[model samples]
Target: MAYVTPAPLTEKSTRTDALTPLGLLTVLLGAALSSIDFFIVNVALPSMGRDLRASPATLEMVVAGYAVAYAVLLVLGGRLGDTYGRGKLFRWGVAAFGLTSLACGLAPGAWWLVGARVAQGAASALMLPQVLATIHATTRGERRAKAVALYGSVSGLGVVLGQVLGGVLVAADLAGTGWRMAFLVNVPVAVAALLCAVRAVPDSRAERPRRGDIGGTLLLGAALTALLLPLSEGRATGWPLWSVLLLAAAPLFAWAFAAVERRAENTGGSPLLPPSLLREPGVRRGLVLGLPIFIGFSGWMFVSAVTLQQGLGYGALKAGLTLVPMGLAQFAASILAPGVAARFGGRAMGVAALVHASGLVILALTALWVPWSSLGPLALAPGLAVCGLGQGVELALYYRIVLAAVPAARAGAGSGLAATVQQSCLAVGVATVGSLFLALAAGPGMREAFAIVLGVQVVGLLGLAALSLRLPRRLA
Candidate 1:
């Protein structure tokens, strides 16, 4: 099939050619795929290990490889959408994602599965940024606000649903495919998304497209890999020499990346991530605030899955079902967040943080007091639901706050940079918090370890509340 280039939207055309409802749904579907894949494999890890005879380290790679690759390539993906066309990239990305998901489903060995997962991550990197970029470019004012809120709702729901769906698929074991079904399901979904893209999804790109920043891309990728790779693998592998070296080198790469970006901007070349963009108060503060929020969020998810399945002896489906209350509450809160933000302004974030921390406190108490035999999904539901509500609010506001000041001309780049920060932090959260839980579990037992981790997370939320107070009273 020949590619049909979409007409570029002028300022006037943008207002006139609103993103159709189906178009928003199509892009949101694509966005959900990326977020869903990040966590879908969590519940399937035990199944995968049994079937493949995979080592613990390889299992970590299965999750980390996808996240690391996705985080590293996101900015380039955004730039490509800006220079080419978002609709074209969306289709290409969806196609690539489908193929990669197939590769993962059919892998014959542990290493092959890891490689396929990395490729799947790369495809996600390509697809996800376009969703935000397209929404940023195509809609404005109240429509833009609603689109973004829905995006946030989908994103949060996707993460929870990934685990839920993974559990259901693994338990169903369709045709005895077992864990592979978790990935194979994406094949049909991607095909549907591609078909919808052809009709419903509009193409949009930067008005003044900038050339890809090769030097900056390489430097940024290296910097992120250096930082995230060690944190992800070091604990499981017993913190080897290579991991320490990578950790030590991370800062150097980051400094070099900064210098290169600064030079590119000074030379009038478009940097992969412009330093000037970071100077924007919205962008800077949003990132600062997001670090703790996502770090705590992902960390909790990672450890919760492990504790439910391994410590409590819950089945995959049961463990996945454990999060259902959280997912439902989160979706509800996300839908209501825009109105809440409009009324309470940035204070809503602080309130949300407090709510999230309260949930963590509840979980910590339950973990400490409840006997293992009596504790189950029912015992955890209230805390999880509260956390969900807080997370929903935070996520919607975070996107609105971050992208509020970005120019339409740089929508792709700006959204991509924001996403990279989010994805990278998620990977780090899993590693750091997961490692802490594992270490404590080994010594103090699962119950004590869980309580400790929740305590740490609560402290992070307190910090987030403090930071949120600094956000401008009105979100854009």
Candidate 2:
């Protein structure tokens, strides 16, 4: 027996409202905002510490809390879109994110701000996974490519732009709120996103939905908390006994979570994360490569911020300005990506990793030799700019690669899984590489520590590039 296939919906045949230019813009706006918030708050940390009288540990938590919650809930959030409606969840998340941003802005104490930040992360997790899912489901070849490129640029730009904007905002101390303005500023943007999302973003869902795997969700959340929380907080807490226990139990909990999810999937239940996604060749390669790219990326940013500010005693604005070379280089490089890929094949990414690693070595050398007071744009700018040059396209290409192997049916789950991995690696970067920088600062001190840590990042990135050379065979 043969089943009949449905007709393709052509642009001319479909309603004007479907895949309209306005719709794409709205979706793109939503994607940009989610990316921006992920890193905007970093520059605000110094002012937040003073305003809230936050301890060093709590201060770190303010950042880590958001990332951890965001990573852990993302798969579930994507699934929620599958079962309910992507449009509905996106709208709700946009609204909730606005309210939580307000809460973060208003909080009087460190703990209160931390809690609100966590809520904001949850709200973000709810909104972001739907972005690619909705776009993939709704668009076709050329349109999809353009939309994806925009998405990729926005995501990369957000991290850099966020810091620049936050630095200016914090320094400006608008209405005397100082760092609080970073959170407060999101309110208006959120409101705008909500209004546009309702009008322009169409409703979408998984064609076939199943009952959610509640057990898997619970166990996965537990495993993430067990592993991430302790690593993120342990150093500030003087490495307590319980922290070690949590670290030790992480693998066991993770295994159990994976087992539970597999069982759920086998029984016809829709697991929060489908195990089948883990088997995709391109997706798996993307995961492996994405780990080091982001780890080096996130860890370096964390260290750079502190080094520029505390180590060199520069104000937030100056530290932020120091990264202008990076941002500008990245913008230019992003536009060259397609051409580069066309000429070099997918190996453009491996070449990018090598270029970025060389830059890191130069940056590390500058910290070693250059006077803290005499540091000029020319001294290290070229290398750091090169790092940004590589980063701009390399990261997005992986996003493209991850989506390449996934089917329409698994788009939501795949996006969720990929985003979760990206988010988790960021946290791990902060814990492993970022913590190494901070620890090195305490004893070997900031200069030497910065050099050593960045050197390590250089090695990791080179290794990742080596791995990338093996990836053509892995492409779907």
Candidate 3:
């Protein structure tokens, strides 16, 4: 790997940036893989469950394990990339992700896949944090803004695309590979990006680097897992006594972890998460909104996939294709988001949230109105499209809103916290919303239960809408 520190792009340097496009592609492609991993597994889960004779608990573990591992390691991942060179770490993470994906695809049993997926999540954390940091370190002004917009779209779009792609891959069976095709598909794309980086991607490192906090890192990881695991796995397991005990202990562990971090900072080491970032108003508000958004979104995906396939008898490919319109709408909206934000302020977040809620409402109405056979893309198109467009616009805005309030010195900490909040919510979504859907489905058929759960999500979306009203529309 090359030791190329990021230089700001300028008129003179732009022409010399032969690797710029390649570098950007490599980064984007790597990011897309992580995004896909999150949603793509949805369609694949039932098949995996059948193949492994797994209970619902195992299926939840498969998803939660990856999310928990990824969330726990994310701050450390970003810090490691900063301490080491971005390019070197990014390349290693990408390569490891490829290996882990292969391991997941070829898994002999459910537990094995769960373990591999956790590793895959860790590799993703290492790579994803660097994607934005690299864009930030290397580009400026309009270029930076554009790159950030794309990053935002890709991040959300990944979930949508993953749903459809997983459906297709699992349904197609891809030479009897079945669910493995979903994971295996990442291999070729990763190889191509690996080649691109060899010639194009530049290296970058942290300025005013701080010592890594091993104690803080471990404590933070433990605290996050301790909180998330009980939530994600407990509902499925009927809230066993141990789950209750784990829930009780989460706060104590978190408090102890924070104290350890403060002590570490006093000793001249960088805690994986800085206490100061938490005190920043905008970043804190962003987390408040982000938590519910991700929780609702992830929970919706888990429930919908099950509803569409097992309940409605749609194939995987069909389930995946259902989200295509939303993905397209999102991509279109994200491209236009910055200009809109510039004119209207952060008001876009609230409006987008309303649009998203409307989309859910529309879909819910369609489900209620149409019989099962009549409900397809047409029924979901308008709401899903609105949701997608609004989501893309706000997601981009969230990045700016969160970071706008922080100093450059605190970028990694700020970004890491943002990611942690989002990921934690996603896990909670699976635990709460997803579990609720399944619980209800046992009494009704899948379709009705799904409708009921989505109705609740509409409430969550409206809450986001209300929160957005609190944002001062005159945004940066």
Best by lDDT: 1
Error of 1 at 342 (Å): 0.6
Error of 1 at 397 (Å): 0.7
In candidate 3, which residue ranges exceed 4 Å CA deviation? 1-19, 52-56, 442-452
Model 2, residue 39: distance off in Å is 2.7
Total backbone collisions, model 1: 0
Q: Estimate, for each residue in 371-424, the C-alpha lDDT of model 1 and write its tens digit.
A: 887898999999999999999998888888888877776778888988998887
Model 3 scores a C-alpha lDDT of 0.78
**TM-score of candidate 1 against the unseen true structure:** 0.96
Give the least accurate 10-residue stretch of model 1, judged by summed lDDT: 1-10
Q: Please provide, for model 3 over 139-167, each residue's C-alpha lDDT reduced to its tens digit, 9 standing for 90 to 100.
A: 65556666777888888899988888887
RMSD of 1: 4.0
Candidate 1: which stretches are off by over 4 Å? 1-17
Determine the backbone clash count of candidate 3: 5
Backbone clash tally for model 2? 0
User: Order of candidates by TM-score, top first?
Assistant: 1, 2, 3
Candidate structures ordered by lDDT, highest first: 1, 3, 2
lDDT against the true structure, each candidate: 0.88, 0.78, 0.78
